[model samples]
Target: MIYIVIPVFNRKEYTKECLESLRAQTNQGFSVVIVDDGSTDGTEAMLRDEFPEVVVLKGDGGLFWTAGVNMGIRYALEQGAELIMTMNNDVVVDSDMIAQMYRWHREKPQALLGALELDASNKKPIFGGERLNWKLNTIEHLLHVLPDAERKGLHPVTHLPGRGLLIPRVVFDRIGLLDQKRFPHYIADYDYTHTARRAGFELFVNYDAKILTYPEESGERQIRSSKTFKNYYKHLFDIKGGGNLRDFTRFTLKNCPPPYVPYHLANGYARRLFGYFLK
Candidate 1:
């Protein structure tokens, strides 16, 4: 059976919509495990009353995205699920998404799978799997390079985003769970895919399977809007914030080769500083 893991906070409306979409999926051989991170907005109570079939794990509001997902992943593995799917609660997936992803996984059992993410407003591609450039020490999204027709089938990727990633049981047994302590939020997805690649697992994106999600805002507006030093520092260091220097540095140092680590660190800070002034 396939187990779907979702990490949620205070967004009851989004969670409800996401669960509703899941319930409408074409494939019914799946169970949902939701890790509710201490939401005070009646999210837990609502899920219990409305969606009783879901397994809800409570948190102390400290388990961020990575920790919450790790908890759900562990629970799914214990339940003997053949495949585990991790997704953001704000995303509403296509009805055939699970079926398509499962079909692809059956064909390539050793491959990590991901689906295309489209903007909920404009129906444009927002996030998808990417190819890593070892020579340039950068990554490029597949959608940017390939046309819609060419991207329809399965294609290789260096890293897959966390939004709608599917992992087989064997991958977990070999590589292990995401690093919740070091990469508690941002860059954890990249770190996981990098680890899987190093351990001889291929990453693929099934463009046929799509999910609708909101677009992330640019950091220029955020930094420009910060009126106080406290707010500026908060945005600068926030894990969800687009430009969290500390987390980016940690991810670079841990994943990049020793020779590229210093270059990446310096480049990351330099870009942020340049963007701050230009904004």
Candidate 2:
């Protein structure tokens, strides 16, 4: 069985739209698991009223993205789900996207899969595969340069985002759930996928399977207009800030070779410092 696990904290309308899109999918073989992490916006009540068929898991609001998703994943495994898809609630997927992803999964049985995310306004890609650029200590996104035709084929990626990502049960059994304690919010998905890749899993983005993304409604995003020296230090370690320096440092130290960690950290700091002044 395939179970789609969604972690939501408020934004009832977005979640409602996401579930509606899933319900309209061409593939009727998948079930949904919603981990509502203390949504005060009547999201849980709405689910009970409208989409009760979806297995709903409640949280006390403390469980952030990583743990919230982990909770639903554990439930899916317990219910004999062979495949688990982790996705955010801010996307509207194409009707055939799920079926397309399943078909690709059948073809690449050992690979971790992600979907091409496009902006809702212009239908242009919002984000794609993220590859760590060690020299600049920043992530390079493929959508910025990928040709439209090339996107119609399979593209290998170093790090796949969590949105519309398909993960087989064996991966969880092998590497365990995402590191919630270390990454409560932002950096968890990249860290989890990196761990999976280290465990011999090939990560990829099947650009043919696409979804419309509401980027403005998504998770913590850094504001370039407010990138000042003091403001940078203020939210440097704050989990709500997208540019959490501590999390970046932790990710670097955990993934980079011991000898390169220092250099990467220094480079990352310099770039952020420059952004403050340049912008």
Give candidates' CA RMSD values in order: 2.2, 2.1
Candidate 1 deviant stretches above 4 angstroms: 216-231, 276-279
Quote the lDDT for 28 in model 2: 85
The alpha-carbon lDDT assigned to residue 269 of candidate 2 equals 76
**Model 1: per-residue Cα lDDT over 1-279, one tens digit each:** 778899999989989999999999998879999999999999999999999999999888999889999999999999888799889898998999988987888889878898988888898887767787654767797778888668685889888888889888888999899988888987788889889988999998888889998654333345556656654565568666656788877778777878777777777788765565454
* Total backbone collisions for each predicted model: 0, 0
Q: On a 0 to 1 TM-score scale, where does candidate 1 land against the true structure?
A: 0.93
* lDDT measured at residue 231 in model 2 versus the true structure, 0 to 100: 62
Query: lDDT tens string, model 2, 118-142?
Result: 8988998877787776655667778
The CA root-mean-square deviation of candidate 1, after full C-alpha superposition on the true structure, stands at 2.2
